[model samples]
Target chain A: MSAHAHGTQHFDETKRANIKFSAEALTTIENLMKRYPEGKSKSALLPVLHVAQAESEGWLSAEVMDYVAELMGIQSIEVFEVASFYSMYNLRPIGKCQLEVCRTSSCWARGAEDVVDYISKKLNIKEGETTTDGMFTLKTVECLGSCGSAPMLQCGAEYHENLTEAKIDALIDRYRSEGTRKNYTDLNYTNSK
Target chain B: MSRKLLLTHDNVPNLHTIDVYRSKGGYASVEKALKKMTPEEIVEEVKKSGLRGRGGAGFPTGMKWSFLAKPEGVPRYLVCNADESEPGTFKDRYLMERNPHLLIEGMITSSFALGANTSYIYIRGEYFYVSRILETAIAEAYAKGWLGKNILGTGYNLDLYVQVGAGAYICGEETALLESLEGKRGNPRIKPPFPAIAGLYGCPTVVNNVETIAAVVPIVNDGGDEYAKIGIGRSTGTKLISASGNINKPGVYEIEMGVPVEEFIFSDQYCGGIANGKRMKACVPGGSSVPILPDYLVCKTATGEDRLMTYESLSDGGFATGSMLGSGGFIVYDEHQCVVRNTWNFSRFYHHESCGQCSPCREGTGWMERVLHRLEKGMGNMNDIDLLVELAKKIEGNTICPLGDAAAWPVAAAIKHFRHEFEYHVLYPEKVKDSKHGHKEPIMPVKPAPVMA
Candidate 1:
């Protein structure tokens, strides 16, 4: 058996035990964990955070980061450093749907400016600010890795590509409806149509 | 006609298995290098081949390996930079996904040459599935005694580890990756102490791209001199390009380095020309970070020679006319696509991904994203164009790492090639329509809810 050194005892184990990862989320974490060599479970920190962010509705609270730290056997500071470093891992709470608009070169050339404006105006929030109704939060991210489509956004895990003012509005409307109905299908499915 | 090398065994089914790989003469290089050749001889062979780093920079691979600090008793490390995060680049991902054993074989041979006992495959977080595949392959190698402790009974003890990053694009840089591997923030540390001298827990380290390391297997097996004869002068060997967007065949294709761009694009052997028979508007010859080249400039260089896919030919005029083969991400766009909107999206990516370690990149990226946002929305002014260019310039060489440059290059290049489009949007805001059809206008003056009292 491989001897594992669970980094530092940073978070309360009792509190961590109370906070459980969903079966799906745990499975995803386990899948990411398999990517590293034995005893290197710390390598899964980022992917686990991604799943946690999704499960917690687009933001990672302190408790959750700590919980993740405990689960990964890494320092809470290590998790904090990661969360604060990348723009994708949200450190604070966001609106129901986190609107991450790609403002990189390819997307800009394709008309991402209009998409940002439309989203900001529609949500009544500037970039990095959550909406008043808590329905949406607007943020400008780097590349979401879909440069071919260009002018894309990541609303939660789903990427909204080939965006326009009308598409941005429809996306907002769909999110609003999904929020109200609690019958949330994939946003990408709607965008594809 | 045939792939000849580089990707000859790519189409062979079950190539990922050790049995299939060895059947096709895999590990032949390891045997040759360990049994007959000296480490110095292997290095010389690679140097003679004129092989350069396939991961964008085009730095000579042998030169990189030679730079490894051989201080008296310290253990040097070998790291394969599998963090293929550049947009428009999916070649490495496919290479690993399809042929994981190739990478493993390369890693083992390279480790022996470098005198390094330990190696790590630093992969990007999004490559979850590919990483799993690699881990499985590593286990297979260890089982066969090709890895870990006296590999092939050569008395060369080696250990391999795979470290997955937290999805930061900057970590793709060697120094930043070293930091991430050490359980630190993924910010790029200052150089002078390059990873060659101090890296991976402050030890001498050699970091290489997935393809660069994988290419070593063939070089060592065939004798570097034979590999050197494959391509044109100083731009020797083949290159694997990930051709995507508005193309008939959007996948990874490996060809000789000196193949012409026109042939690569229009030839049935390569991309099979643009999709729907659409006219080509522009080409991002490299990855997203490269400058865009209009169709007219895509043909031959000023010397009237065909713009071959070699490093020298593609970057003939630098950013002024051509772009580098950075990571071989060849993205083609049709005339219908608007350049301004495309630039805006790229700006947003940089802004969001900036590690916030420096003032220029952190603030400048955000400002560029905002200005591009207004421009794409048709609320942009004439001065915003210059402002965008100025901001990009500020962030260009001012950041802690090349991430800033990666973020700025596309903006500077977009404005250089398509300033007129930006001006058009400013002059005629009413005529500028969103590319997505049938979408409605967003409500004006969106404001976030005030903090609770």
Candidate 2:
């Protein structure tokens, strides 16, 4: 659905420094680095990328990756390799809303295809296609551990499970009305225990 | 009512909070463990309880804990494998989502028992919401002096942190999880010093599943022998089953290990039978990795014994007519579901998730996916079925991790259980090309078990 840097980008020092993360985000990154033993700040790379992606645009550009590598005291290639390895880190810019529907065995058998088709048609887009307005990006991911509540789609930090056409319609309408980029680090999607 | 050790307080409102959890006898185990019991005594109790690892491996937890090499002045680690990305498996997610404190309390008690001062719950990045819930609970634990230096004044200090993974299923593997934890790719490590000797940060570590860690709370509270007395032989204690697919009531169920498979699937108390009055065609008793069982063999073993949900009973007949109790991910397939398409879906998942460290898994999974895709699309020759079997055999134990075997088992078992379905697809392609492609009746061979290639 989204494009990734194919491991050919060079880390420019000036570009890395120009890529600014929010002051709060930098503080959070520094705090995360403290979780590991001294000289082991590399352990904070994944979490820092999460906060970085949220603080910057929805995706991690090469400059952003370089920035992360510089901050974590590791090579830029290290950040690139780790970031590309995970599906959650969007390397390229994505739509405001990324609807990752689970398409593995349990979700598939329980009608995930129908959910995808419904969302695609509702948004006038196909699988892996962002809408013309760049309001939504549709993706078919493996599983998000909601097998029991299958036919589920994950947007940002929220899981919308047991989908129907009406629910998809309502969800899309709500997102369009809200016109906000849903992010994983957004505290509003908190599902209280 | 079935006994639920971990989720006994699941329906209790605000059970996720430390106050409610502790009010309901939550941190008592931490108190008992830190103040009264020694680390060796806890390990001995777990060994006596017959608690097996619930993260699909089913290794004895006590034996695993005892295997930790406690050398002089070495910092051993306890990492809770919360990377619950297995298909049809969400028990760990459900456990953490509803009852965060139970797992936190378990982590504290377990870290004390494991003699580790620092522990981490390496949750998948997808569950950021759940991680936030856990972090809040951990903060509460810290505020109340349950964590940090000198916990409970018993001189056993444990700092529990929740580290989120980026999105990789291979990270669920212990070594791969360790590598990811160290800010590297999620490729699995080659075994034989294993994790007990050399794991996280290249130190001796004990990596356990979320359920395995949470079970430690009850083991400490009620004694492992008492916990052992609840379920059948070997499969002691209750297991959390993440039931989904073509079922009337698809949700998480904590069942005693000795419950009959029929009752659990058909009875109103559990899955409540096939959805929309459809007949059950097949079932994956454990997670997607374990072999699938045809309807005929789902309720009873080949020996006509009532199939129970215990580890020993569910896998009574080996892979021929049985499946392992893998992560307790129970997926039921109705008569309307197509086996060939399901096999292809699973193959594609493996192909996507394989970390490419092992060539056999990385290449073999893609090959199987392509073949299964061709077969599912009704474009396969008769030889393609056997070719699929051949590919599965080649990939089955050839990888650095079980992801290859996990990818192989469903393909082999799909053909093993439903060869006729594949043939039907080949012989009559037009019948399945339309939108109304449902396997009306299944032809399951019960006489002779097909020998694995």
Candidate 3:
């Protein structure tokens, strides 16, 4: 019932039939569910919702939330409450590259506001607005645990840190040229290890 | 240049891999805990170490573990509170990202001590990269006999799982974290049924910070008494301080407890003094949640006693002239930084992060943000300052969780320490509106216009 007038929450019934996890993703979800006890597969809802968001573009459609609820054996309201509570989950549509810059104390002290302003000027879009080409959506987020490397932003799974105006320019150019929808699943799990 | 207990080999190569970690005596504590010592003895050793929780509250770790309720046929759970979303705190992420196997080994030892067969690392969602690092370490742990099933022919079976929370700052609260781990909205549960008694599917649960669990490694390796000998007074063992903001070296440093606050800030080996050769104006020696202290108060107490980083020393004057060593998130602010704007930024963060479960926190945080915004933007009268004080007092002890307190402290501290800055914004409205006052330097120097084609 909590609605933001950015995007339609309802999706076509036909789209719901097609929306699902890939074989490998399903295996990952099953393994995740196994981490809990019997009849506690619902505990995997948050992580699984991330997977569903990755699969169905960058944001969570109502159909995707319902599907996640079904997959985890929880109610639709449960999924909606969770999806809305978290800042990471975008209920509406977003650009190909969602630039979530940290605007908290540590990052702010180190010039996060300047970085936000720089990105806005470069993209000609205000914070939380997608570019006309649907290439970038600039958003200011809270601390992302990369405070040491302050004035940072996250695009897909990449954390661009120690940001300068020139670095922001270069990053914008790179993401713009990539020209593909960068899903949350675009993360490189191997690189982090 | 200080003693490094937990981060002993922070600079070692291939430390992330289990093979490299094991080569350097990684699972020795697990061996010591499981094969050598009994569960009670392990608990006794932690109590002897005098180790306190590193995740902000500074609770006694050994006493916390001893409080776990054990009903027959009911399993106990150990959850590592990796949801390190505190604004200026990133020490846990650094530990888990660079030296992850240490945390896993620590988890195994802790799980054994608590008789817990299942454990979880509930990390913040934004640290997706660090989560994978932890997962890889966990898989490597399982591949060996360190985790899962009986270990070294001992009748102890343990399963460790990593649960990633979708971004909620309130989830850092233990009860809220349990709700999040149960895949629910992270609203802090009212106490009386604490997590130790009834938590996580109504089972006995022990939630500790990643640093707290990882510190158990050293406490088990070296006898608790030996570990206790390193630091002064009750603040035993070395601690990880995540230094950021206007400090020259903004990273995680593992320092022996009882280090002098001034030395930690100005010394060459530590933060290396204020950034850009600027004078120190103010600081939140802990994370953003703690009271902000000006230069003189931060270095020494009102009684002129040298302030040390210990819990007792840092809070010598009790909020009137003291702050906390909370979570060891040392944030420095140069004289150029504006207190009004910084307070406004913190207000916005709290407002955005409020879970909206309690009306005081939900509505009060928003009201504080709006008032601070007007004050910062030079549109407020002087009475707004008194209004902020009143609202902060009302919200402090009235909420279900510490978040209301967290939100209230910065505002209260800013007003307590830097009322002149707010007055400056109000008095010189036009001047303060265009050019931010208090800070002598610009945030980011405007780069020259790009060469026109």
Cα-based TM-score, every candidate: 0.79, 0.96, 0.95
TM-score of chain B of 3: 0.96
- The full ranking of all candidates by lDDT, starting with the best, is 2, 3, 1
Candidate 3 lDDT over B1-453, as tens digits, reads: 688888888889999999899888899999988989999999999999999999999999999999999899998899999999998899999999889999998999999999899889999888887888888888888778787778887988998888888899999999999999998899999996988999888899999999999999999998899989988899999999999989899999999999999999999889999989887888898898999997878888877899998999988899877999999988888877888889989999999999999999999999999999998889999999999999999999999999999999999988888887787778878767754455543332122234567
lDDT of 2 by residue, A1-193 (tens): 3332232256566766677877777778877887887787898788888988887657888888887887888898999898889999987777889999999989999888888878877778888777767778899999899998888999998999988888888998999999998887752221221
Q: How would the candidate models be sorted by TM-score, starting from the highest?
A: 2, 3, 1
Instruction: Point out the worst 10-residue segment of candidate 1 chain B by lDDT.
Output: B437-446
lDDT tens per residue, model 2, B1-453: 898898898889999888898789889988898889988899899998899999999999999999999999989899999999889899999899899988988888878878899888999999998999898888888888988989888777777777889899999999999999998999899999899999989889999999998898888899988999999888999899999999999999999889999999999999999999988889998888999998989999988999999999989889888888999999999888888888899999999999998888999999999998988888898999999999999999888889999999999998988898899889988876753388454444444655578
Better of 1 and 2 by DockQ: 2
Expressed as tens digits, the lDDT of each residue in B1-453 for candidate 1 is 634565778889999888898899887878887778888888888787788998888899999999999998888889999888777776787788788888888888888889888788888755555666787778788888888787767788887766656567888788888777765678888997888999877789999999889889888888788888888888888888887777776678888888999999999898899878777777888887787777766777744679999888888988877788888888887766667767776777677667788999999999998999898889999999999889888889898788888889888877777777787778878766665411232111112234577
Tens digit of per-residue lDDT, candidate 3, span A16-69: 888877777676666677779988878888887777788776889888887887
> Candidate 2, which segments miss by more than 4 Å at Cα?
A1-17, A187-193, B439-453
Fnat per predicted structure, each in turn: 0.24, 0.79, 0.71
State each model's C-alpha RMSD to the native.
10.2, 2.9, 6.4
